[model samples]
Target: MLKDRNITLTVPAMPEYVDLVRLTLYGIASKMKFTFEDIEDMKVAVSEACNNAVLHAYDKDDGTIEVRFAFVKDELSITVRDYGSSFTIEENKETPAMHGKSIDEIQSGGLGLYLMQALMDRVEVEHGGGTAVTLTKKRQRTEEPA
Candidate 1:
Protein backbone atom coordinates (compact mmCIF):
# COMPACT_ATOMS: atom_id res chain seq x y z
CA MET A 1 0.00 0.00 0.00
CA LEU A 2 1.12 3.56 -0.72
CA LYS A 3 0.47 6.54 1.47
CA ASP A 4 0.58 10.05 0.12
CA ARG A 5 -1.13 13.41 0.36
CA ASN A 6 -3.97 13.77 -2.07
CA ILE A 7 -6.40 16.53 -3.00
CA THR A 8 -9.39 16.21 -5.27
CA LEU A 9 -11.52 18.91 -6.82
CA THR A 10 -14.58 18.76 -9.03
CA VAL A 11 -16.12 21.62 -10.94
CA PRO A 12 -18.67 22.19 -13.63
CA ALA A 13 -17.35 21.81 -17.14
CA MET A 14 -17.13 25.44 -18.10
CA PRO A 15 -14.38 27.68 -19.40
CA GLU A 16 -14.90 30.12 -16.59
CA TYR A 17 -13.85 27.45 -14.07
CA VAL A 18 -10.52 26.80 -15.74
CA ASP A 19 -8.82 29.61 -13.90
CA LEU A 20 -10.04 28.24 -10.62
CA VAL A 21 -8.32 24.97 -11.35
CA ARG A 22 -5.12 26.78 -12.28
CA LEU A 23 -5.15 28.79 -9.09
CA THR A 24 -5.74 25.67 -7.03
CA LEU A 25 -2.76 23.91 -8.55
CA TYR A 26 -0.65 27.03 -8.17
CA GLY A 27 -1.34 27.00 -4.47
CA ILE A 28 -0.60 23.31 -4.12
CA ALA A 29 2.66 23.62 -6.06
CA SER A 30 3.74 26.53 -3.95
CA LYS A 31 2.86 24.69 -0.78
CA MET A 32 4.96 21.75 -1.94
CA LYS A 33 7.93 24.14 -2.28
CA PHE A 34 8.20 23.98 -6.06
CA THR A 35 10.29 26.66 -7.75
CA PHE A 36 8.50 29.57 -9.36
CA GLU A 37 9.29 28.30 -12.83
CA ASP A 38 7.98 24.81 -12.07
CA ILE A 39 4.82 26.21 -10.53
CA GLU A 40 4.25 28.31 -13.63
CA ASP A 41 4.74 25.29 -15.84
CA MET A 42 2.23 23.31 -13.76
CA LYS A 43 -0.25 26.13 -14.02
CA VAL A 44 0.02 26.16 -17.77
CA ALA A 45 -0.27 22.41 -18.10
CA VAL A 46 -3.25 22.17 -15.75
CA SER A 47 -5.05 25.09 -17.33
CA GLU A 48 -4.65 23.57 -20.74
CA ALA A 49 -6.02 20.25 -19.53
CA CYS A 50 -8.97 21.91 -17.84
CA ASN A 51 -9.67 24.08 -20.86
CA ASN A 52 -9.68 21.09 -23.14
CA ALA A 53 -12.14 19.26 -20.91
CA VAL A 54 -14.42 22.25 -20.75
CA LEU A 55 -14.33 22.87 -24.48
CA HIS A 56 -14.46 19.39 -25.93
CA ALA A 57 -15.83 17.07 -23.27
CA TYR A 58 -19.59 17.46 -23.44
CA ASP A 59 -22.26 18.54 -25.88
CA LYS A 60 -24.65 19.54 -23.09
CA ASP A 61 -23.86 21.61 -20.00
CA ASP A 62 -24.28 18.64 -17.74
CA GLY A 63 -20.83 17.37 -17.07
CA THR A 64 -18.09 17.77 -14.50
CA ILE A 65 -14.32 17.82 -14.56
CA GLU A 66 -12.52 16.09 -11.72
CA VAL A 67 -8.95 17.00 -10.84
CA ARG A 68 -6.82 15.20 -8.34
CA PHE A 69 -3.35 16.00 -7.04
CA ALA A 70 -1.24 13.43 -5.30
CA PHE A 71 1.98 14.33 -3.54
CA VAL A 72 4.43 11.55 -2.85
CA LYS A 73 8.10 11.59 -1.97
CA ASP A 74 9.81 13.89 -4.48
CA GLU A 75 6.99 13.58 -6.98
CA LEU A 76 3.56 15.02 -7.64
CA SER A 77 0.96 13.36 -9.82
CA ILE A 78 -1.95 15.28 -11.26
CA THR A 79 -4.98 13.71 -12.85
CA VAL A 80 -7.69 15.52 -14.80
CA ARG A 81 -10.82 13.62 -15.77
CA ASP A 82 -13.99 14.46 -17.67
CA TYR A 83 -17.12 12.36 -17.74
CA GLY A 84 -17.91 13.32 -21.29
CA SER A 85 -16.47 12.26 -24.63
CA SER A 86 -13.42 10.09 -24.63
CA PHE A 87 -10.13 11.13 -26.29
CA THR A 88 -8.37 9.36 -29.11
CA ILE A 89 -4.68 9.51 -29.91
CA GLU A 90 -3.61 10.81 -33.28
CA GLU A 91 -2.36 8.32 -35.86
CA ASN A 92 0.98 9.97 -36.66
CA LYS A 93 2.70 8.46 -33.65
CA GLU A 94 6.35 8.84 -34.52
CA THR A 95 7.67 8.17 -31.04
CA PRO A 96 6.42 5.59 -28.57
CA ALA A 97 4.89 8.37 -26.51
CA MET A 98 1.76 10.08 -27.73
CA HIS A 99 3.52 13.42 -27.42
CA GLY A 100 6.38 12.33 -29.66
CA LYS A 101 4.80 13.74 -32.81
CA SER A 102 5.50 17.31 -33.74
CA ILE A 103 2.90 19.96 -32.95
CA ASP A 104 1.90 20.22 -36.60
CA GLU A 105 1.54 16.46 -36.99
CA ILE A 106 -0.74 15.92 -34.00
CA GLN A 107 -3.61 17.78 -35.65
CA SER A 108 -6.29 16.62 -33.24
CA GLY A 109 -6.56 20.26 -32.14
CA GLY A 110 -4.97 22.51 -29.50
CA LEU A 111 -1.46 22.50 -28.05
CA GLY A 112 -2.63 21.32 -24.62
CA LEU A 113 -1.33 17.74 -24.56
CA TYR A 114 1.92 18.81 -26.13
CA LEU A 115 2.51 21.42 -23.49
CA MET A 116 1.61 19.03 -20.69
CA GLN A 117 4.02 16.36 -21.89
CA ALA A 118 6.70 18.95 -22.53
CA LEU A 119 6.40 20.44 -19.08
CA MET A 120 5.82 17.35 -17.01
CA ASP A 121 8.17 14.42 -16.52
CA ARG A 122 5.50 11.92 -17.53
CA VAL A 123 2.10 12.23 -19.20
CA GLU A 124 -0.46 9.53 -19.81
CA VAL A 125 -3.91 9.59 -21.32
CA GLU A 126 -6.43 6.90 -20.37
CA HIS A 127 -9.86 6.33 -21.78
CA GLY A 128 -12.69 4.25 -20.41
CA GLY A 129 -16.16 5.77 -20.27
CA GLY A 130 -14.40 9.13 -19.95
CA THR A 131 -11.04 10.76 -20.64
CA ALA A 132 -8.28 11.19 -18.09
CA VAL A 133 -4.96 12.94 -18.47
CA THR A 134 -2.33 12.28 -15.84
CA LEU A 135 0.64 14.58 -15.42
CA THR A 136 3.58 13.94 -13.13
CA LYS A 137 6.56 16.10 -12.19
CA LYS A 138 9.48 15.28 -9.93
CA ARG A 139 10.76 17.95 -7.61
CA GLN A 140 14.42 18.79 -7.29
CA ARG A 141 16.20 17.23 -4.35
CA THR A 142 18.80 19.24 -2.51
CA GLU A 143 21.74 17.59 -0.74
CA GLU A 144 22.22 18.67 2.87
CA PRO A 145 25.77 19.42 3.80
CA ALA A 146 27.31 17.12 6.40
Candidate 2:
Protein backbone atom coordinates (compact mmCIF):
# COMPACT_ATOMS: atom_id res chain seq x y z
CA MET A 1 0.00 0.00 0.00
CA LEU A 2 2.83 2.42 0.82
CA LYS A 3 4.47 1.80 -2.53
CA ASP A 4 1.90 3.87 -4.32
CA ARG A 5 1.76 6.70 -1.84
CA ASN A 6 3.62 9.31 -3.82
CA ILE A 7 2.84 13.01 -3.61
CA THR A 8 4.16 15.90 -5.66
CA LEU A 9 3.92 19.67 -5.80
CA THR A 10 5.25 22.32 -8.15
CA VAL A 11 5.12 25.90 -7.03
CA PRO A 12 6.55 29.15 -8.29
CA ALA A 13 9.85 30.07 -6.75
CA MET A 14 8.20 32.73 -4.70
CA PRO A 15 8.25 33.10 -0.97
CA GLU A 16 4.48 33.12 -0.81
CA TYR A 17 4.18 29.78 -2.57
CA VAL A 18 6.14 27.87 0.05
CA ASP A 19 3.23 27.77 2.45
CA LEU A 20 1.60 25.17 0.24
CA VAL A 21 4.57 22.89 0.68
CA ARG A 22 4.49 23.21 4.43
CA LEU A 23 0.77 22.66 4.68
CA THR A 24 0.84 19.64 2.40
CA LEU A 25 3.69 18.12 4.34
CA TYR A 26 1.88 18.58 7.60
CA GLY A 27 -1.11 16.73 6.26
CA ILE A 28 1.01 13.90 4.94
CA ALA A 29 3.13 13.59 8.06
CA SER A 30 0.04 13.58 10.20
CA LYS A 31 -1.53 10.90 8.07
CA MET A 32 1.66 8.87 8.40
CA LYS A 33 1.46 9.14 12.19
CA PHE A 34 4.64 11.05 12.68
CA THR A 35 5.18 12.57 16.09
CA PHE A 36 4.45 16.23 16.49
CA GLU A 37 8.13 16.93 16.90
CA ASP A 38 8.97 14.97 13.77
CA ILE A 39 6.30 16.69 11.74
CA GLU A 40 7.49 20.10 12.84
CA ASP A 41 11.06 19.21 12.00
CA MET A 42 10.08 18.05 8.54
CA LYS A 43 8.09 21.18 7.91
CA VAL A 44 11.00 23.38 8.86
CA ALA A 45 13.46 21.43 6.77
CA VAL A 46 11.19 21.42 3.77
CA SER A 47 10.64 25.10 4.07
CA GLU A 48 14.33 25.79 4.25
CA ALA A 49 14.89 23.85 1.06
CA CYS A 50 12.10 25.68 -0.67
CA ASN A 51 13.30 29.01 0.58
CA ASN A 52 16.74 28.34 -0.76
CA ALA A 53 15.34 27.56 -4.13
CA VAL A 54 13.31 30.72 -4.13
CA LEU A 55 16.21 32.87 -3.02
CA HIS A 56 18.91 31.36 -5.22
CA ALA A 57 17.43 29.20 -7.94
CA TYR A 58 16.50 31.88 -10.42
CA ASP A 59 17.94 35.06 -11.77
CA LYS A 60 14.37 36.36 -12.02
CA ASP A 61 10.97 35.39 -10.76
CA ASP A 62 10.35 33.03 -13.63
CA GLY A 63 11.07 29.58 -12.27
CA THR A 64 9.31 26.89 -10.36
CA ILE A 65 10.41 24.41 -7.75
CA GLU A 66 9.14 20.90 -7.76
CA VAL A 67 8.76 18.82 -4.64
CA ARG A 68 8.00 15.14 -4.61
CA PHE A 69 7.36 12.78 -1.73
CA ALA A 70 7.30 9.00 -1.48
CA PHE A 71 6.42 6.65 1.32
CA VAL A 72 7.70 3.22 2.19
CA LYS A 73 7.22 0.84 5.08
CA ASP A 74 9.10 3.06 7.48
CA GLU A 75 10.61 5.88 5.52
CA LEU A 76 9.52 9.11 3.88
CA SER A 77 11.49 10.55 1.00
CA ILE A 78 11.09 14.09 -0.29
CA THR A 79 12.88 15.58 -3.29
CA VAL A 80 12.91 19.25 -4.18
CA ARG A 81 13.97 20.26 -7.67
CA ASP A 82 14.70 23.69 -9.03
CA TYR A 83 15.89 25.00 -12.38
CA GLY A 84 18.39 27.61 -11.35
CA SER A 85 21.75 28.11 -9.72
CA SER A 86 22.49 26.51 -6.38
CA PHE A 87 25.48 25.80 -4.16
CA THR A 88 26.29 22.61 -2.36
CA ILE A 89 27.33 22.08 1.25
CA GLU A 90 30.93 21.72 0.21
CA GLU A 91 30.68 24.96 -1.71
CA ASN A 92 29.38 26.61 1.41
CA LYS A 93 32.19 25.11 3.46
CA GLU A 94 34.75 26.31 0.95
CA THR A 95 33.38 29.80 0.55
CA PRO A 96 34.91 30.73 3.89
CA ALA A 97 38.44 30.12 2.75
CA MET A 98 38.16 31.74 -0.68
CA HIS A 99 37.28 35.13 0.75
CA GLY A 100 39.36 34.81 3.90
CA LYS A 101 36.23 34.49 6.02
CA SER A 102 36.14 32.18 8.99
CA ILE A 103 34.52 28.84 8.32
CA ASP A 104 32.02 29.49 11.03
CA GLU A 105 30.99 32.74 9.45
CA ILE A 106 30.54 31.31 5.99
CA GLN A 107 28.81 28.24 7.30
CA SER A 108 26.36 30.42 9.09
CA GLY A 109 25.34 31.87 5.75
CA GLY A 110 24.24 28.40 4.76
CA LEU A 111 22.05 27.99 7.78
CA GLY A 112 19.25 26.55 5.72
CA LEU A 113 21.42 23.67 4.60
CA TYR A 114 22.52 23.03 8.15
CA LEU A 115 18.98 23.05 9.45
CA MET A 116 17.85 20.61 6.81
CA GLN A 117 20.69 18.25 7.67
CA ALA A 118 19.95 18.51 11.36
CA LEU A 119 16.27 17.80 10.89
CA MET A 120 16.17 15.17 8.16
CA ASP A 121 17.59 11.67 8.51
CA ARG A 122 19.27 11.86 5.11
CA VAL A 123 19.83 14.65 2.57
CA GLU A 124 21.35 14.41 -0.89
CA VAL A 125 21.81 17.38 -3.21
CA GLU A 126 22.43 17.33 -6.93
CA HIS A 127 23.55 20.34 -8.93
CA GLY A 128 23.26 19.45 -12.60
CA GLY A 129 20.17 20.05 -14.68
CA GLY A 130 19.03 22.26 -11.86
CA THR A 131 19.32 21.50 -8.15
CA ALA A 132 17.63 18.57 -6.56
CA VAL A 133 17.56 18.17 -2.80
CA THR A 134 16.31 14.87 -1.52
CA LEU A 135 15.52 14.36 2.15
CA THR A 136 14.57 11.14 3.88
CA LYS A 137 13.23 10.39 7.32
CA LYS A 138 12.45 7.16 9.10
CA ARG A 139 9.26 6.50 11.04
CA GLN A 140 9.33 4.28 14.09
CA ARG A 141 7.13 1.28 13.65
CA THR A 142 5.92 -0.75 16.58
CA GLU A 143 7.00 -4.28 15.88
CA GLU A 144 5.00 -7.35 16.80
CA PRO A 145 6.83 -9.82 19.02
CA ALA A 146 7.74 -12.70 16.75
Candidate 3:
Protein backbone atom coordinates (compact mmCIF):
# COMPACT_ATOMS: atom_id res chain seq x y z
CA MET A 1 0.00 0.00 0.00
CA LEU A 2 1.10 3.55 -0.67
CA LYS A 3 1.34 6.14 2.11
CA ASP A 4 1.59 9.89 1.56
CA ARG A 5 2.48 12.87 3.72
CA ASN A 6 3.15 16.46 2.76
CA ILE A 7 4.68 19.39 4.63
CA THR A 8 5.63 22.91 3.68
CA LEU A 9 7.94 25.24 5.60
CA THR A 10 9.08 28.78 5.00
CA VAL A 11 12.44 29.89 6.25
CA PRO A 12 14.34 33.11 6.09
CA ALA A 13 17.01 32.99 3.44
CA MET A 14 19.71 32.63 6.03
CA PRO A 15 22.51 30.09 6.47
CA GLU A 16 21.59 28.99 9.99
CA TYR A 17 18.33 27.42 8.84
CA VAL A 18 20.30 24.98 6.74
CA ASP A 19 21.01 22.89 9.82
CA LEU A 20 17.37 23.05 10.84
CA VAL A 21 16.33 21.73 7.47
CA ARG A 22 18.91 18.98 7.73
CA LEU A 23 17.63 17.98 11.13
CA THR A 24 14.06 17.92 9.94
CA LEU A 25 15.05 15.77 7.00
CA TYR A 26 16.84 13.34 9.33
CA GLY A 27 13.72 12.95 11.42
CA ILE A 28 11.43 12.43 8.45
CA ALA A 29 13.76 10.13 6.56
CA SER A 30 14.36 8.09 9.68
CA LYS A 31 10.62 7.55 10.09
CA MET A 32 10.37 6.61 6.44
CA LYS A 33 12.82 3.72 7.05
CA PHE A 34 15.79 5.21 5.25
CA THR A 35 19.11 3.63 6.13
CA PHE A 36 21.64 5.67 8.08
CA GLU A 37 23.72 6.24 4.97
CA ASP A 38 20.61 7.09 2.99
CA ILE A 39 19.47 9.53 5.63
CA GLU A 40 22.86 11.21 5.60
CA ASP A 41 22.74 11.50 1.84
CA MET A 42 19.27 12.99 1.99
CA LYS A 43 20.38 15.47 4.61
CA VAL A 44 23.23 16.60 2.42
CA ALA A 45 21.07 16.91 -0.65
CA VAL A 46 18.34 18.82 1.18
CA SER A 47 20.88 21.12 2.75
CA GLU A 48 22.36 21.90 -0.63
CA ALA A 49 18.96 22.76 -2.05
CA CYS A 50 18.11 25.01 0.88
CA ASN A 51 21.50 26.68 0.76
CA ASN A 52 21.10 27.26 -2.95
CA ALA A 53 17.75 28.92 -2.41
CA VAL A 54 19.14 31.15 0.28
CA LEU A 55 22.38 32.08 -1.45
CA HIS A 56 21.45 32.14 -5.14
CA ALA A 57 17.73 32.72 -5.09
CA TYR A 58 17.31 35.25 -2.32
CA ASP A 59 20.78 36.70 -2.37
CA LYS A 60 19.49 39.94 -0.86
CA ASP A 61 17.40 38.22 1.87
CA ASP A 62 14.34 40.12 0.68
CA GLY A 63 12.16 37.01 0.23
CA THR A 64 11.29 33.70 1.82
CA ILE A 65 12.35 30.21 0.79
CA GLU A 66 9.64 27.57 0.58
CA VAL A 67 10.36 23.88 1.03
CA ARG A 68 7.89 21.04 0.57
CA PHE A 69 8.33 17.41 1.51
CA ALA A 70 6.17 14.51 0.38
CA PHE A 71 6.51 10.90 1.39
CA VAL A 72 4.70 8.38 -0.76
CA LYS A 73 5.09 4.63 -0.56
CA ASP A 74 8.82 4.00 -0.33
CA GLU A 75 9.72 7.23 -2.03
CA LEU A 76 10.33 10.67 -0.57
CA SER A 77 9.88 13.78 -2.65
CA ILE A 78 11.22 17.24 -1.83
CA THR A 79 10.57 20.57 -3.46
CA VAL A 80 12.43 23.80 -2.75
CA ARG A 81 11.13 27.00 -4.25
CA ASP A 82 12.30 30.59 -4.37
CA TYR A 83 10.96 33.78 -5.91
CA GLY A 84 14.07 34.72 -7.77
CA SER A 85 15.58 34.47 -11.20
CA SER A 86 15.94 30.91 -12.50
CA PHE A 87 19.16 29.20 -13.55
CA THR A 88 20.03 26.85 -16.38
CA ILE A 89 21.33 23.41 -15.51
CA GLU A 90 23.31 23.10 -18.71
CA GLU A 91 25.13 26.30 -17.98
CA ASN A 92 26.11 25.09 -14.54
CA LYS A 93 27.54 21.76 -15.69
CA GLU A 94 30.35 23.52 -17.48
CA THR A 95 31.94 24.49 -14.19
CA PRO A 96 33.12 20.99 -13.25
CA ALA A 97 35.22 20.66 -16.39
CA MET A 98 37.61 23.41 -15.37
CA HIS A 99 39.83 21.11 -13.33
CA GLY A 100 42.71 22.54 -11.27
CA LYS A 101 41.56 26.05 -12.12
CA SER A 102 41.55 28.87 -9.60
CA ILE A 103 38.34 29.71 -7.77
CA ASP A 104 37.91 32.62 -10.15
CA GLU A 105 38.41 30.37 -13.17
CA ILE A 106 35.79 27.95 -11.89
CA GLN A 107 32.13 28.90 -11.73
CA SER A 108 31.08 30.28 -8.39
CA GLY A 109 27.90 28.23 -7.94
CA GLY A 110 25.66 25.30 -8.97
CA LEU A 111 28.09 22.75 -7.59
CA GLY A 112 25.51 21.99 -4.95
CA LEU A 113 22.90 21.19 -7.56
CA TYR A 114 25.26 18.71 -9.13
CA LEU A 115 25.91 17.08 -5.78
CA MET A 116 22.21 16.89 -5.02
CA GLN A 117 21.55 15.27 -8.37
CA ALA A 118 24.22 12.71 -7.71
CA LEU A 119 22.82 11.77 -4.30
CA MET A 120 19.10 11.66 -5.08
CA ASP A 121 17.32 9.20 -7.30
CA ARG A 122 15.73 11.98 -9.29
CA VAL A 123 16.20 15.73 -9.46
CA GLU A 124 14.09 18.10 -11.54
CA VAL A 125 14.21 21.89 -11.74
CA GLU A 126 11.59 24.34 -13.03
CA HIS A 127 12.51 27.92 -13.69
CA GLY A 128 10.48 31.10 -14.15
CA GLY A 129 9.90 34.15 -11.99
CA GLY A 130 10.52 31.55 -9.33
CA THR A 131 12.50 28.30 -9.28
CA ALA A 132 11.44 24.92 -7.95
CA VAL A 133 13.61 21.85 -7.45
CA THR A 134 11.97 18.47 -7.02
CA LEU A 135 13.99 15.59 -5.55
CA THR A 136 12.96 11.99 -5.03
CA LYS A 137 14.57 9.00 -3.31
CA LYS A 138 13.41 5.43 -2.88
CA ARG A 139 13.77 3.48 0.33
CA GLN A 140 15.67 0.23 0.35
CA ARG A 141 13.80 -2.94 1.26
CA THR A 142 14.91 -5.95 3.28
CA GLU A 143 13.33 -9.36 3.48
CA GLU A 144 12.55 -11.02 6.80
CA PRO A 145 13.26 -14.70 7.30
CA ALA A 146 10.42 -16.96 8.34
Best by lDDT: 2
State in Å the error of residue 63, model 3.
1.4
Residues 1-146 of candidate 3 have per-residue lDDT tens digits of 22777878888878988787787778788888899998988888888888888877765877777888899889999898889877887878566576678878876665788799899999999998888988899999978898
Instruction: Report the Cα lDDT for residue 14, model 3.
Output: 87
For 40-144, candidate 1 gives per-residue lDDT tens digits of 888888888888888888998899999999998778888999989876777324334545678766555456788888999999999897899999998877678
Greater lDDT among 1 and 2 belongs to 2
As a TM-score, model 3 comes out at: 0.88
**All candidates in order of TM-score, best leading:** 3, 2, 1
Off by over 4 Å in 1: 1-3, 91-108, 143-146
* lDDT against the true structure, each candidate: 0.84, 0.86, 0.83
- Colliding pairs, model 2: none
RMSD (CA, Å), each prediction: 5.0, 3.8, 2.3
**Winner by TM-score:** 3
Residue 29 in candidate 1, Cα distance off native in Å: 1.1
Residue 121 in candidate 1, Cα distance off native in Å? 0.4
The TM-score, computed over Cα atoms with residue i paired to residue i, of candidate 2 is 0.84
Per residue, candidate 2 scores C-alpha lDDT tens digits across 75-140 of 898899998986766777654343766666555446778789999999998989789999899987
